[model samples]
Target: MSGQLVRSLLIALATALVAVPLGYFVAPWLGWGVFCLGLGLQLLFHFRNFARLDRWSRHPVVDASLEGEGEWDGVFGRLYRHEKELRQQIAQREQEIAMLIAAGQALTDGVVLLDLEHHILFCNRTAEAQLGLKIEVDRGQSIVNLVRQPEFARYLSDNDFSRPLSLRPERYRERVYAIHVIPYAGSRRLMQIKDVTQEDRLDQTRRDFVANVSHELRTPLTVLAGFLETLQEIELDTEERQRYLQMMSDQAGRMQSIVQDLLTLSSIESAPPPEDEVVDMSRLLDKLRRDAEALSGGRHTVELEIDGKADLLGAEPELVSAFGNLVTNAIRYTPPGGRVRILWNRTPLGAEFAVEDTGPGIDAKHIPRLTERFYRVDRGRSRDSGGTGLGLAIVKHSLGRHQAQLDIRSEVGKGSRFAARFPLHRVIAQG
Candidate 1:
């Protein structure tokens, strides 16, 4: 504004100097005409500058870089500075947005942002993989159309969002997701998807395990109760009373076995891992052999083979229980006079304690679940043999504590070999 005022005064002074000379030497009329022409020229220049500024503003995006002299120059410079400031602000906001998106991508749970119209605005990589969505391709598209699940559609449509919705997305590899819809900004929502398949399976397994335990205990208690009622109410001969007492004793023993095994399992699972130490494998196996022979009472032929001299490094009690359980299982499962062999050997991978039994082997289908508590290939036969179904499960847990694995291989009519293989780190070579 100061520059414009100074320039205008200079033009007027120059015009007046020329006009005064014209009026003194020539004519007053000619001096007046020169003054009017000079003023008209000034107005013309002002209008031209205004037109340039107008044209720049008329476009969708204004170019604030128009070069000019005097007042116009200052005006153009200020506009350019303002436009640059606006651009910088926009760039900074975009950078922040990118950082937020990157953080979301690093999360395990899927995150998605939706507009009021249910159009997908943004989604993280987890969301894309978990929900079968293409982050880039699916933007601006209706989320419901892509999901294609009536339950999911209903979940979205429902206004009550106190809890998350859980359902399997059939379109995407039968994955289970816990979807939480959080409403914000009037009608906009943030949808977060969490994959809960493993969690759900564990919950179901726990429920089944608890139910199985109840059923197992109920049967023995019911048997005992019935026998006690019979003994109290009815009179019987000495032999008959002895038989009834013996039957009750057997039922009581069954319940005791179940309780002991359950306690063992619970203790192993709850206790912290045992401190590692060297264990004499030969001595342990010898003790286990003697126990098996006593349990067998010479009915089954028990054999022990020490292939490689390597003492194991682990909790002695756990190792003893694990190895002894395998050996006892062989003795219990095999028929009278069948051979039950216990082998301690060192392989390239590690040392192994394997028990091979000559009995009715397990079916291929039952091998996978043999370690589950109370799971049996033949329940009636297991009970008849005084075998608690938890024996194999205990073996599994004990070996797991030692960082060992149980490999069971069996064939019908042949035999089954249950091997507890220990890693080299757990094996110390002995002379």
Candidate 2:
């Protein structure tokens, strides 16, 4: 502005210098008239330039065609360059904001921003779903008012954020979330919400597993201890002493079986999937039939049916353990004179190894949890039948390694059928 004014003043001074010299030689007052006319013309030119600047300012867009004339050209050029730079900066900022939003959406956790008054500022899609909020509707609204959770309101009011808050919203009763609020940017706060349902479930499972192990071990250990103490302190007859020893050995064997099953389950869980060795279904079925008959000890009728020429593509030992568990479970559960049938069959999708028994069937509710470690339909009956309870759990893990699925269909008092179906990819045709 100052440069433009000085240049204008210099032009006016030169006009006055030329007018005074030319008009003084013509007349006395003519010099003043000439100077006045020249100054008026200069003012008119300045006014036109100002008018052009005003029109551009109303809708300022950087256009080369809008270049100014004479002294104003430098001013317009600078304005165009400055406007272009400003636009570039704005575009860059917009890109950064877009990337940040994308990253937030991709995250597993939810994010929310709030003002000092706890009014909602911004939130990601995850936050909306987790908190049951709609950003468009909830924005600028008080978070406590919208959430309406007394605990959340209290958490904010207390101003204590050293630990995260665990919440189980009524809307999502089964899910658990951990929310942490951090103060940032002077007065604003950022709330990070993470769904911890799986973590909480895993923690509970670990606790239950430990408790079950302790309980299972304690029963057998107590029996062994009692028997040992009686043998050491009392004078028993030969027959009585032999019976006590036999009972002790039976309890020892039960503990050993439990330990071995636990080890097998742990190995299956920790180790990678075994090599896909061709498992001979014929030989495997023959072995399973013999093991079932021996386990049944003629109490139940054991049968084997091979309906398919398809062998499994999996580690032989894993397949054996998986198939053997089902057969053993069937024989154990079947009553005396009941039938236990082991079958290798082909389905449209692939192949299946199934065990059917004429035992009392499982309840529908218990079917889903049947594969859980130490889960039993009847604890007393299972223990009496010498079941480790980890049999089904081990079977599940082994089948999973072979890319197979276990299906259980049962009805009360009608018996049960347990089938392990292998995907087509895991089935090998025997030539």
Candidate 3:
């Protein structure tokens, strides 16, 4: 603005000086008043043009009338238009940036932006919650200082933007996260954290389960096949033949039991959650106890205790299977004179069914993995008891489908307790 004012004042002063001298010398020969008037009008016109140019420069658009009027007018007009278009483009770009920021905020995965210097430039809401970040105070802070994980720091420093780093936050002890850093334009980077803990654990569990099941099945199958081959190759007496056949039959039956339990587990996992319906808890427990006692063949005494009045609302068959498996396991693991108890009781929030046995209890370290398929605390004892190693796995899946939880309490050399708790909402009065 000051520069334009200076140029205008210089032009006005120079024009006046030349005009005054020309008018004084030449006007007397012509008409003095006319020349003076013409010069005055010329000065007024130049002053008006300067004022118009100043006003137009401040505005986004200049008056088109200013064009072609003078050399300076044409130059100023074109410059004004060019600047106006550039401003409009900048406004459009800013809108796009705002939209992208909004989209990033709505994303499920946590997002963080960092500059070339590794300072946090921006973070979305998801990132704020997941990372426990105070964006206002943390902005411009170094990422290495804020995120103290050594693996994450190495991941960023290595510039391995393609692969994500796995991390377990202190807040979610059971979960795992995958963090990815992607290099963006202007030497900036985008860091994304995704929750993949469940998927990863499930994948690992499936792999281990398949391997365990194969091993468990192969052992019995190999034994049965070998025994049959020997029997076919040699001649045996009637008693020896009958004993060999009985052994082979037992091995084959063990394989059959394992396969059956596998199918039951698969069915439970694949099936949808059971619909709510009133079930007679007392009747169910009584029937299961009788069946367990019968299956025990006078070896172990089976007892039933029902203290719950609320009916269970779930798939009856699944519940029966789950409960029956617990009772049978207790009977099988117990000694010939041992006793098994099945109890159903009510609590404030729900109903619980517990199966307790007077058999050797499991170690504390092996309690958590007892529900895993083919995960046995004592492999030899489990196999000798004719366990398929998938009973608890089936129970786990079945209870899960019914929105129930299993609690196992055990101590070595003492007895163990296996209980299933069903939520109050899922329990109804018998109709």
Best by TM-score: 2
Cα lDDT tens digits for candidate 2, 163-198: 999998878889999999999999999999999999
Winner by lDDT between candidate 3 and candidate 2: 2
Sequence-dependent TM-score of model 1: 0.88
Residue lDDT tens for model 3, 293-407: 8989998888888785778889999999999899989988888888899998888888899999988888899999998888888899889988888899899989988889999
Off by over 4 Å in 3: 1-92, 109-197
The C-alpha TM-scores of every prediction are 0.88, 0.96, 0.72
RMSD of each: 3.1, 1.7, 6.8
| Per-residue lDDT over 26-46 for candidate 1, one digit per residue giving the tens place of the 0 to 100 score | 999999999989999998999
- Could you give the candidate ranking by lDDT, starting with the highest? 2, 1, 3
Best by lDDT: 2
Candidate 1 lDDT (Cα, whole model)? 0.88
Give candidate 3's error at residue 252 in angstroms.
0.3
